[model samples]
Target: MEEKVGQLAQIAGVPYESEQSEITGPVAEMGIPRKLLPIAGSVLGVSGAETVKRIQDNYLKENRLGIPLIFMVDVIHGFKTIFPIPLAIGASWDTDLAEESARIAAKEAAVSGVHVTFSPMVDLVRDPRWGRVMETTGEDKYLNERFAESFVRGYQNNNDYSDPYAIAACVKHFAGYGAPEGGRDYNTVDMSERQLREHYLSGYKAGIDEGAELVMTSFNTVDGIPATANKWLLDDVLRKEWGFDGVIITDWASLGETIPHGVAANEKEAAQKGIDATVDMEMMTFTYSNHLEELVEEGSVDEEQVDQAVLRILKLKNKLGLFENPYRTASVSDEGSIVFSEENRQKALEVAENSMVLLKNEQNTLPLVPNEEKIALIGPFGTDENLLGAWSWRGEPNTASQVLESMRKVVNEDNLLYSKGSNIEEITTEQLEEAVQTAEKADTIVLALGEHWEMSGEAASRTNIKLPDAQLQLIKRLSELKKPIVTVLFNGRPLDLNGIEEYSDAILEAWFPGTEGGEAVTNILFGKANPSGKLPMSFPENVGQVPIYYNRFNTGRPYESAPNDKYVSKYLDSSNYPKYDFGYGLSYSDFELSPVQLSKNEMTPGDEITASVTVTNKGERAGKEVVQLYIRDLVGEVVRPLKELKGFKKIHLEAGESEEVTFTVTEDMLRYYHPDQTFRSDAGEFEVFINNSSHTSHTETIVLTNK
Candidate 1:
């Protein structure tokens, strides 16, 4: 019983060189039994070939069955060579690049003795106030689902983990984790079952369908029951409905949280609910470790449940090839060559270049002239090398490329002036004056600004989503110089561009472009590479407009179709729309999208209709454009969203070049879960809008019939 229960619980491991040589600190605080450390099924957040080998070697000597400890880490974005955050990856809208980034990340982690990565966080996010929004793809379910599959394929190497370079992928925070109340992390989440099925579950479903080896439960509750203990979600929805035979683990300390969540009275009850809910593993807590053995012996919990959980754990370890060789890819000799290689860094550079979105370019202010222009690079992030953003465990900031250094490679050092405009939080009078003086001498001001790397990961939720007062003041001061300001932002979430946009001539959304961020942004600024990224998440006009997205349902008194003018669903002081809608972006070249052309106006369940659009580059240079296709059911049994993204194609076009892009719309694309819980498309009128962004006036109508 002890061995079975230990396999069902995952505890933190100690570093081989630690002075005490045992799990301490937070683990000690959690009251995990010290005797169970050797028999524990897995270890969390400990890596490196030498350390992993030492821990596993020592554990096997003490264990009876010689079951190896599987190592897991929160390798969300990168292992050593960091890429842009997932939100930035979504902006690129290039699934191939997203896949390549994950492949590179998996190669680095696999060589470091890691078995599983809690990556490709497919939570569909709408509220930027939720600091973890940076960890997701975007608000759209279709976009999230696409990236989810791409990341899984990249991580698992097409789900064939037998290769030494491949590692298992774990899709995380299942079931509406992104829509916490008031955009607060770990807060109570309340929504109808229909809302949950429609908007939230698609990403997780896509990852699971892609053969992800594991799924991590969310911290919040579904229908007022915490997800870790919700039997319907884990057993009925995930197991029975989705047919997910892989392991399901709780988030960090989430199984124990069921007690605080009022679902369980004690650790014993938490253990009972967790196993009954079919959660295969408990992470970072002793709830299952200490109490499960007692529960099974007392006959309160069935022994077969514990045996099934243990079988899943052993199967995963065998899948990782841990039984044949406990140290599968963990080798100190090969670590230096496999991890952080030049080839991997080059891929990081390419991904970063495509991830940055050019938000505003009035009068063609960007793509600055290289040697001819006198440029002033000023701000906290101007010379700061911490562009790796959040969730980078092994990424070294000192090795990162900086904006000032990369700019000097193109322009003469004398032509470029540099200044620390201000700290992230506060600025001195001398600093502001120096920044203005630097800008006065330069022909153009490139202001680099962003939230600190610590500002936006887990537990970093915020109410105000605007730039700090100090950075805003510096923008106000820099505007006094009357120079062309090209603002480069390094934030994680879609921020409220309140005071900065009013002063800047051009704006670039560079969401903490990773290791090669400095060179990538410089290439875009100097016309070496065109900016082709788009906004995956909408930027709100103000913090009050948050929980803002493009695909919202029309209310009975919607502002667009309302009968009464004054009593419509509109904000009193602010506009109901976002400052920048989803899929909104600009590049050096301009591309014009033609009207939607449908093959036929009517189609049956088994029939397919082709929606075609002609995209033409009308500018003088070459560029890439992400042509988006959105559909809307004119009427449904339930209220439908104004529009939902069905498909998109990213195509490259030279000046004066045109491409005819066509998407085949099928009945499966229009299916939805109705009030009766049946998944099917209703026979109705539909509208197809093929454009650059979600906000479009042009559309072509279609009809779905039973025949």
Candidate 2:
């Protein structure tokens, strides 16, 4: 322990302090210094088999434990083949593809010598204000649990964590980071024990269940204590209840964040608190490197905790077979060897194309008929880079092809008119004239709108997530144009789109498409691609519905009424409805839900039943329909939601075709968190709805009795 501590982290009084300088600073990283790894040895984001070769040359070549250093990178969505963000992927309910997406991400990231990925961020968030929601699977325990398992299997591939790229999966923010106050990053979290177990802790357990090898401590405090130093969380629930044996790393400089958290006296105190809480690795090392040894020598902390941390790190490395292959798989000559080829590009394009969500198409304004005339593309995001949203590492905006260039390729460059309507945050009139004039020259107008990437990521929280006034005003003005207007939105989180919906003829949510986003947009526009992407989150009409989701609890007065008068959960100012509910999307084709056919009209806690419905493609074209299954526990010991998303399935059908989609309504799917904190189903009458969208649907009823 003494030798290794001095070798890498450079704490004085530890053996082999001479090797400390080898670990250089100015570590190019996505987060703070402790988590910031030296780029000199990192071959990450490097294209090809050369990535593997470089990892061996840079990290494994040292004269130390002879164990290779594990390479870690972000594979949040899909790897080379990017699927929807974890949230969108969850909405897909296509477990096989979601798992395959993870596997492919691991495969691609592994090919580049990455040993681990900071992914499957199982932070169960209820607040949509948290910008990081775009990264999680969603807000349901069962759904998140299912996705968490898929993610682990995708990343780890069985019990073998030693596959070069088959690195360990990290179950993150240890506990309750997702329940941040007011939906802000690093905010305080306060919840009852029952609430914590029922809502937030399930995803962590699910990840652990699927063999997640590491846990990243959250930035927030659970109840009164910081999660980074909470023994009840890290030691008790994580270690005891879930039995997670992997190392726990703090969120970038989280140990140092103790000063702001008002938990520790100084760096030494922070180190002691975190070490006591069972933090296995100090991210960025400001607290640990600066004060760990002092605490150990001063007897403020047990030296055993430090050794325990190192032990976890070593074990993870050994699991990756680093102790076996300490040599670079290839040499510097192999750096550009060959990877990220045409095949990978095609796969990325395919995913991006599939991820496009066609949110609105009024008057059948979409499927733009290819023409020989001019096209107009306007909006700040049309040509600018970096607003594509969050956590895209080393994202180069200038290099990413802009929307204008893409439209030019689809049409004729000479005929494509371009205008930057306004910047993402600011409202302006300067570009309105230019945009209108450009639109005058084109046969069609495709206006891009939405928040800048920073407007929605970590600390990127917002009080008002609406379209900027300038862009909204611009769209209002452009709506008067003779040209058909198609608004392409570049967003991270769901924005309130009532203004745009009223003005734009068609609206396409083009979430900051990654590297090949331009191609995806162009293909979808020209009908070369069909958008099958579904909304992973609810889109509210205004800020008043900030916390609204598909799965919300039923209040004393719920949204049911016989007339226009009385007491209910109805808001005096607005309806208790989202602008677009979760799992809501539109396609060129139309689908109709038939009468639900349950295998039986009755169910008991022990017996299972299947709710089946026939979906018919009423539109002329073949399309994909995500049939949603929502259930309501009519009466329960505790308050229950009016309806909750129990299950959903995306079925593709040919024109005029019908397919029967069925879901097994098991007791687990019917169970709810009770006042006693137990997940048990209650016997009662229930309403089941099988719908095409969240707000619109078909319904049936069933009775549950004791067997």
Candidate 3:
């Protein structure tokens, strides 16, 4: 019984294995028993082969049962050879690249004595103010669902953990961790069950259905009860309804947080609620470790519940092949060869290249001629090496690629002028004058700017999502030069681009491109690579127009339907549109999309149709285009979105090249949760729009018959 309770506990390993374990700060504060360290089921936030092996060896030698400790880390984006942030990866819209990035991350982590990664966030985000939105794919459910499957497949290797390079994929923050109130981290999430099922649940459901081995409960509340202790969320929905039999783990210290959440009276009650909710493991807390044994003995918690949770933990360990080889590939000698390898770095560069979105290119200002144009690269990010954005636990920032150094490799030293316009937050007069002087000496100015690496991950939420005032002042100073200003932004979440967009001639959303970010951005700037990435999340015109997305349900008094009227659902001070729409992007080369052609005008529930369109690359260079398909239910049992993304295809076309893109639409694509909570499609008229963006105008109609 003691061993069973210990298996439910996950503690930080560094303190547990320290020579002064009895006096360590974290361990002593937690009040956890010194004897329980040997029996603890897992370790959190510890990496590297040497350290992990030492800790694992110590636990096994002291334990009576000989159960190996499973190691877990936040390996969110990349392990060592980092890739772009998840939001940037979503902009690429290439699932193949997404899968490859995950595969490489798994390989690197596996060799470092890691067993599971908490990644592929897949949270549906619309509010750019939420710092963790940078960790999500985007606002749309369809795209999130697709990326969820891709990341899970890449991590678990199609759920076959027998592969030496594979690691278990844990889809995180289950049940609306993204939609916190006012875009605050760890805040309450108040929404109806219908809203939860309609928009917030699909990504998690998709990841689970794709064979993700574990699910991490969210830190926020669902239906007013904290998710860590909500039986309706964990047991009723995730376990029974979704049919997920895998292990369920809580977010860091979340089970203990139930006390402040008012759901539990104390640690004992928190443990009782967690067990009743079917929470298999508690991370970074002793709520279960300190009280589970007592609860079971007192009859408040059944012994069978404790046994089931212990069995789940053991099953995950057995599946990881830890029982046979305690060190499943953790080797100090092999780690050097496998982690951050050249092959992995090249893949990171490719993913970075595709992840950048060319937001604005007036008069074809981009794809600059290196020798022809004397370029001035100025801003805080011009020489900054910390491009690996948030959640990069093991990624080295000082060794990462830099913009100024990368530009020197392509352009002559004399052709490229450099200056720091300002620091991230504060600007001095001397710095601003030097930046302006540097821009005056160059033919064209390339301004590098964005939020600091610390501004966009967990616990980093903001009320205003915009470039800092210092950077905006720098842009204002450089814009006065009138020598075409090209802006390159390095941010995690989408920003309010009002001030910068008006002055810049061309804009590239680089999104803190990881290890090879410098080379990747340089490639796009000099035409070595054409920018093909799209906006995964919408860029708001101002902070006031936030919480904006493409697939919103139409209001009875929609601005579009009643423009110029006072009673419409329109902002009085701001426009009702985003500065940039979802799926919107620019390319050096031009591509034209033809009208949508449907196979049939009507169909039954079992029927299917093919929507085809011809996309032509009329420009002088080759480029890739993401052909998007959207469908709108004209009427439904419940309110429907104006248009939902049904399908998408990314195709490459050279100059004068044309390709016929086709998507097969079936009844499954039209399914939704009804008023009665039945998950199915209804017979109705639907409008289909096929274009490169969600802000599409071309439309076709089709009907679904009850017969």
lDDT of 1 by residue, 616-645 (tens): 999999999999999999899988899999
lDDT of 3 by residue, 23-104 (tens): 5576788666675788889899888898888888878888998999999998988999999999999999999999999999
Candidate 2 is scored at a TM of 0.88
In model 2, pairs of residues that clash are: 34-284, 35-284, 71-115, 388-512
The collision pairs in model 1 are: none
Tell me the TM-score of model 1.
0.98
TM agreement with the true structure for every prediction: 0.98, 0.88, 0.99
Model 3 scores a C-alpha lDDT of: 0.91
Model 2 stretches with alpha carbons more than 4 Å out: 4-64, 78-93, 289-307, 327-339, 372-374, 398-401, 413-415, 425-430
- The Cα local distance difference test for each model comes to 0.90, 0.70, 0.91
lDDT tens readout by residue for model 2, 1-707:
34444322311111111232343333323222332222111222333345445534544344344445455556687544444456656655566666766776676666555667777888876567788877776666666777788888888886575554465688786788877878888888898987788678888888888888878888888879888888888888788866777878777778778888898888788878888888877655456655677878888878887887777877877777766764323233322332334554465566566667888887887888656667788888787766335776534446555677777776766777788877776656667888888888888888878777777667777777777787888888888886688988877777878678887778888776766677778888777776677766677778777777776876665567533766776778887888777777788778888888888879887888889888898988887778888888889887777677777777889889999999888877777778886788888788888887666557778888887
Clashes per candidate (backbone, < 3 Å) = 0, 4, 0
Clashes of 3: 0
As a whole number from 0 to 100, the lDDT of residue 185 in candidate 1 is 96
Q: Which pairs, if any, clash in model 3?
A: none
